[model samples]
Target: MSDPVRCMTVCRVCGKEDWLDVLSFGPMPLANNYLAPAPSYDDEPRFPMDVIVCRSCWLMAIRQVVSPDVLYRHYVYISSDSRQILNHMRDVANLAVTRFHLPAGSLVIEVGSNIGTQLEVFRSMGMRTLGVDPARNLADLANARGVETLAEYFGEGLAGTILEQYGHPRLILGRHVFAHIDDLTDVINAATRLLDPAGIFAVEVPYLLNLIEGNQFDTIYHEHLSYFSVGTLRRLFERHGLRVVDVARFAVHGGSIVVFVGQAESQWPTGKAVFELEELEVRSGLTNEVAYQRFAERSGRTMRELGALVRGLVSQGKRVAGYGAPAKGNTLLNACGITARELQYASDTTEFKQGKVLPGTHVPVVSPAYAHDHPPDYFLLLPWNYAKEIIGREKSLLEQGIRFIVPIPEPLVVSNESLKDAAFSLSHG
Candidate 1:
């Protein structure tokens, strides 16, 4: 079935009607849509991915609409599977406990929680944890692992049910989930209602500055409705009588900001980080159309360079297999016109993705063990943001003269010695 593309006539942040077209990735497949082996190439569906920025608020968003039910009903990603993500969650859980001084039985709730990665950390610390998620598989898995989860979409109505069942929570959180939602007002209202008067509500969003500076245009997809800046985020919360009390930046998912929100009447003072980041966004022209225009130009250049490198290698009879079959990878592959002929297959760590095929390009998905049995001459790091962890995990391949090709930020080849040196620098420095 084909998905519908609807134009967003109003700015989600400020309720303004003016929006400027920024970059168009053309028609692309749903980033997480992995195909069965029997499905023919013609059966695959592709939707338009036109990114636009609000002239009033400077928020970047994909106006093309696709139903969340079609995108996340049977999601494949499990946060605990990624080592880096698990570590980050642990760090966050610990900080929440210490910084907020959460009691032993304090309630912690995470909306859109995937496999209870963060909740599990809190549960281990003797805190009562609950996960609210829509993916049935993930919800069931989390329940089996002792993290009680509700398998339903979250909103104002659902928040009432939670409030009636479980008392107001001390902490409410979401990671990389807010941007995926279309109705921000409902979600924020729900969180505000369920939070204790003095409780903290935190969310992690991929930073817009990092996306533009790193040339990560492939991150745009139907699922992510908004590209937020601190200024826009602050405005959104202030409109709902919620105050952003703290802002912490981290290098996860390329780069992200963890924003802590509380009621407007709460005594917690707003931190300097929020204002500092807002100033940075203004100075960097993050809210301007010209910045996005430059980003589009860089994206085109990256597509040309990546295509030439991979196709040139294949033309010389060299084998190239991709590592990490992420949603962003599919965007890059389709936008760059890369096909199975150019790169033999993509390898992923998740067992569910093994044997499936990436959407659009028909690149077969296999296990990382393939690198040992049928090692490619050059391995393409699809999830280039985790280059350090990936290089360290596959150091054996590096030792075997398997040079890695990182395409984002800049296209470059990493030799064995260079990979070792880079890993050492990352670990030591």
Candidate 2:
């Protein structure tokens, strides 16, 4: 069983004890804990899944803390699984190499480098690469693919060891991994130590503003301890003697921000992008509590709407199944009380997830090939972050009159008619 949920009395970002309740999903099983077939539900573990914001720092975070061991030791998600992610990682590597002026033979290290997909890009760019991740299986996969990876959690200790063994890295990249860390200080301190004098530390995380504005509550899982806006990220990095020199936004993963940091005393000047994003955050009311409250209200409404949509479709005798079994999808399913009764099964390309059942929901997971053989009338697109890619790839199904239900921002059905309407609206407007 996983460890009991530990409520935080003090905010991890600002050391303040004042917190404002934002959203709660009551008790929920770990999002990635896919169960064996015919497993006992009574023996499963659940923890409080509550979200709160630090009144002082304006940082959004989950109040309940789960052990990292339970979250990532044998992780199932692979970075290379998604074609969109692979393309995005290649773009990131190219940008980093060109923008940072990383010369050939410069060392690039990545934290949470699942299966070394991103690191492979850096290597292809003529840069030496290393990866640090806690998932032993993923680390082994990385090694097998010729990407040197360490099967250990990254922290000050591991950072020192890496520095001693490989010397200072020209670039330290953490893509979609920094938000999972509970100790921001330790990680930043380690990055500071492992960075060369002229090196850059680039970290990418899902943008808090996008999460709120897009009503992406499904992204709130135990693994993601903190949600960050540019303002909060600036403060966090500043506290560790690092300066945010540059910021870049990407539409991948719903929305993400890549913040490039350097030593506080470095000659690097803070780019206008950082100031612009910080200003945008203020304009979006991310510095206040009202935005979060509205987000919570909208989240509840989304849950109800998605449930209603799925049930309504089922009532019409239309078969519905989930398109992907992402961790975020589990949160959405469990929170909405959706079960195998609603979604017959979830189809995924990941072999690790095949034959397993979604936590709490008990929705069986099947291979994409199997799902195609027994296609449902409608597919609930679980990985809405990759909506365009998935929908485009499944064009044949849409042509065959199959529809997809996108449950984010608002629950809507995507069909040929909807596509034409959207295109017409955009072209006319």
**How many clashing pairs does model 2 include?**
0
Q: Global lDDT of each model?
A: 0.86, 0.88
Question: Over the stretch 1-429, how does candidate 1's per-residue lDDT look in tens digits?
Answer: 654556688888999988888888888899989988874678677888898888898889998878888888999978845778878888788877787788999999999998887887888899898899999999999899888999998899999899899999999989899999888999999999998877999989999998998898878888898988899899989988899998888888888998999999997788899899999998998877889899988999999999989999999999998887988899888888898888889998888889999988889999978756888999888888888787777777878899888888767888788855763343210
Local error of candidate 2 at residue 360 (angstroms): 0.8
> What does the lDDT come to for candidate 2?
0.88
- Identify the runs in model 2 with alpha carbons over 4 angstroms from their true place: 1-4, 423-429
Error of 2 at 390 (Å): 1.5
- Candidate 1: regions farther than 4 A off: 1-4, 420-429
Error of 1 at 247 (Å): 0.5
Query: Model 1: clashing residue pairs?
Result: none
Residue-wise lDDT of candidate 2 within 83-105, one digit each (tens)? Answer: 77878898888888887889999
